[model samples]
Target: MKRYQFNEITTMQYIFLISGTQIGIGILSLPAQLADIANTDGWIAIVIGWIISIIASTIIIKTMEKHQQDTIFDLSRRYFGRTFGTFIHIAFVAYALLASITVVFTAIHITQVWILPNTPNYLIMMLFMLPGFFITKNGVRILGRYAEVVFYLTLWMPILIAVPLQKGTILHMLPMLKEGWAPIIQAVKTTVLSFLGFELAFVFYPFLKEKKHAVKAMVIANSISALTFLLITITCFIFFSPDETPLLIWPTLSLLKTIEFPFIERFEVIFLSFYLFVMSTTGIPYIFTTVFGISQLIGKKDHTIVLLVAVCIFIFTSFLYNPSFFHVQTLGSWWEKYGLWGAYFFPIGLFIYTSIARWFQRGKKK
Candidate 1:
């Protein structure tokens, strides 16, 4: 029996939530990022990254399992004490906020460039964020439902990606390991950004309905995302020449441009339009987590106040300036670095610390 049933999400919801989070704005540019380092072998880096992400996500799940009913907020306080725990919470909130902002910027940038060049950035953001506000305010159940819906809604996306393969050169992807392991290993760091969303398992783990299946859920979620990345990456690698691939910014979207149908023209526009649903999965989770963290810090049960505050902050920040494409990419690069710290290093370090602490406590009791 769960103490708070409102927040408890089902196993499938858990899977979709994490999967949706991982497949965000990064997908549009991941093929380019990987191509920059590994050339045609970039798809290999995505595989390696997926394996690493699965391991990392499993570790996070194990750590949360120790304190089955407690959120990461409570776990940090338990491990680090009050003052330091508060500091850690603030840092996570910052990470989540920045991640959300990056998604917003990416969505706006793509929308402006591909769809509406003349629309005001702030106007786009306002329309963009409205659904997030309404969805996030309801609670994790609503968020989970939204993730599930979006997952199915976009399920056909990968199939459409294959349309570009008719023109793709399969030979470009041959000669595997042509650059040896160095570049592929180096490119693994870039793929880490694509795997960023899995870390949210920490916060969501306690809400899982089937606690024992947490690892299985994570594996499924991550594999779905990994396969999607692989298919898309491979498609891009095959579709573009080695030298030509890295030059294009949004290779995934560019591939969609090659898609021709009797009824539709400029297919990339339609893809980008529906992609807002995909992007929302990323934005909503981060924004929800940020506000949830803030509410936890203040010991508030109701998250509505923090949610309102977060919305105001997000909207106010959008007013500052419209960033150029380079600026958006720069911000994304920084967020990836920050995500490395918050998502991987921090969780792994904390898990080790918790394990040691528990071992010592048991030894003392003996």
Candidate 2:
């Protein structure tokens, strides 16, 4: 797939793209998930994870700075040669596919439970899958545009959450660190899992319009996500007793239950319905990156065909397997382990390798 001038995304689109991806289905359960492990200290864990994400993102940008026009796939081929690079690309492609389809399945499961209990998983999958294809097929710029649009559309959501907070108690979060940092450290893994989507910087950095601003963009992206997650984490802790939190499956959704809306009966249903768009902002980038990586691997110009086929296969596969909440957690466990390697360790390792190799090349030239 050849890169086009239009494929480049502006700094704002760039910020929204990475941040938007980071804030997906995870937000619904993250506060409760963290509270289960660390009590009110879970929000602290999110801060730790956010700092870690920004550091890793900066490393990723520094790695790509050497070849500002090349993506992870291109870098692998440059430094590691064709065979190893192809293997590396294949590994990433598989990871992205797992993540993309897992996101789709998770979204379907959430929607089924909250809004459409009677709807078949396949029917719901189709509804989600179609938009994914159309959103990603146009390429990254469209993805940036989609992400930006979704970000603005959901900006008013804080107001929806504010009504419930009035009833919440600051007392619930007091006596912080009752169990000490041990529990907070245990919960870091959960927050890091929520922080998983920043790895797309591997794909996005090459297309960034202003390379000088990449670090700033990365900070803004992580800050936006960290703040959003932090706010929700604190709200849930304050709104629900720490003991009551882990009991509710989607505490953030339940947080809205306290809000008495004039026009709507179940506020969660309305919120979940609109969140379908938010879910797309999360999944579409993974889908786009998956197809793009595969196309570049095979030296194909037309990733649109690849995108269509992958989406259809995913929709088809959903009919065979319908995951419950426990099953979704099982899927999340797999992603968490894989994501640590794919999104975290891999970039740091790659950056070191490239820097050393570049140093040796400069020595030879000297």
Candidate 3:
């Protein structure tokens, strides 16, 4: 017989959590980025990038499978000595801290530009963090449930996107791979980075109620993210001319402007307003993972204290440092570089080390 943890999340919740993490603020700008590098062939890059992400996610799952009941933090301690283990935990702490802050700044910048031009960033941040603290403090189950709900709540978006496509020209994307395969390959980095949320499996794997579904869950999560990006990226390619696509900073959000209804005049604004639910799914996971990792590092059963301190520190930091749009952009650039290494390169290294280490152990036992 198997015993389940008191606050375990189901396989579906696990899928939603990772997908929600991957489908954040990046999607708004990804089409424009791909357009810059690959021109009309950028959508192809998304598919390639999706394949790479699936492989990386599978590697992470395989690494964690050796320690089914332990998170990355605990695995680090077991795989490496105490000193090196603590270093990896600290690295994760820093990554999650910066990642969460970057998400806050990115969302704040978008909200101010689209809706509230007059509100202070700190005030907006306070509003965001309050609910964030409440949700994360409850535990992973709440975070998982929130993600699942947000996933369903935002399903109407594809139908809404279809409204703009009514006027889109399919000719812009007709000559696919116009410049050959080089541009698509180059643009794969951007697409892979957009799929960054899958790394959270390092923390989420242990909380999964059913261990057998880990790889399957990752495949589902990455597929949903890739398909959604394909929809958005392809929509942009068909909607805008090749020359015009690269010039836009947020082709996905800009696409929303074309939506029309009897009651709504500016559709993008309404769309972004509801998009907060989607954004929270990203932010809260980082928040929970950061606090949860810290609690485990310090040997605490409850993460509430660390969560409280982290929230207070961020709220206070917001008061002092109000990043400009350019600042946020620069921050995101740095985060992407770090994410590429953290989520991709590091996982492969860990998997190699794990395999060798276990091999040596088995040889010694025999």
Candidate 4:
């Protein structure tokens, strides 16, 4: 029963962690997804989505604050007692596992589609999952460092995306929200999936070095994600006709293909290579959070075994299933529905319950 040291991360690292996690494979198709629903005004949905994400993130922070230095597992136990709390904890672990699966599989699927069309899916999943386990096993500090590094390394992506706008038609974005509020609301629903990673804040909240700054970090992180989504979505809208936009999957990557350089051929190939770093930032954090949550629930001080178990399960499942493009999209759509519950609805529900419970306890004390 050896206890490992808990690694703490700075507020800034926390911000990068949340931002990097949220901006994953979903961003590749976000513009097209929104366009299908909201037309050119999809960026408006991003704004609305950001606001919703920020509010949800703040609630998560406040919830964690109520149980200082305790992970969600500990808080659940305190609120629900050991038996039911462990059940709740296990449920969250399951949710985190589903999230990690969605991320790694999506990344592997994208790699196969864009880079190595002939590469075996298992190989791609292993390549992504193995390195992630190595990083994740070290705990949150290492993860925070990896996220910060990925952010600096890929900062050039947005600028590269902007290059395509030179050929874009500004008029394409005109007649704003022609379809009005309904479509934008629908687009916001889709955008909520894109903002999925912030909810990981619950697991990582106790690891923040400056816990008081947790809300601020979450707000900044969600804002960065929102701004990034807004930029890429607007860039795509102005560049492609509304009808043309929804037809192209991975609209962001397609935009990269439009950029040509004298020395470089197939610019997207290079972009996708570096983008693996970005994708790992999303997957590894979820993997760590899931494994760590299970460790806490099971009273394990050493999480390495749990990590290995989780990775092995991921590999086994990914190896067994070879999803087609349409199947993968459908799978992701289903996960997004689940994500809304685990990320947004769960936190809000927990917060309200905790408040009512706390009020009852105070009345009893008086």
lDDT of each: 0.90, 0.88, 0.90, 0.88
Question: What are the C-alpha RMSDs, in order, of all predicted structures?
Answer: 1.2, 1.5, 1.4, 2.0
Q: Write the per-residue lDDT of candidate 4 for residues 104-184, one digit (tens) a residue.
A: 888888888889999998888788877888998899899999999899999998898899888999999889879879989
Off by over 4 Å in 3: 1-4
170-269, model 3: which lDDT tens digit per residue? 8889787688888889999899999999999998888899889989999999999999999988899889888898999989888898777898788899
| Clashing pairs in model 2, backbone N/Cα/C closer than 3 A | none
**Cand. 4 Cα-lDDT:** 0.88
Model 4, stretches more than 4 Å misplaced?
1-6
Taking the tens digit of each residue's C-alpha lDDT, what string does model 1 give over 200-251? 8878888888999999999999999999999999999988888888899899
RMSD of 1: 1.2
lDDT tens digits, residues 39-90, model 2? 8889999999999999999999999998888888888899999899899999
TM-scores, each model vs. reference = 0.97, 0.97, 0.98, 0.96
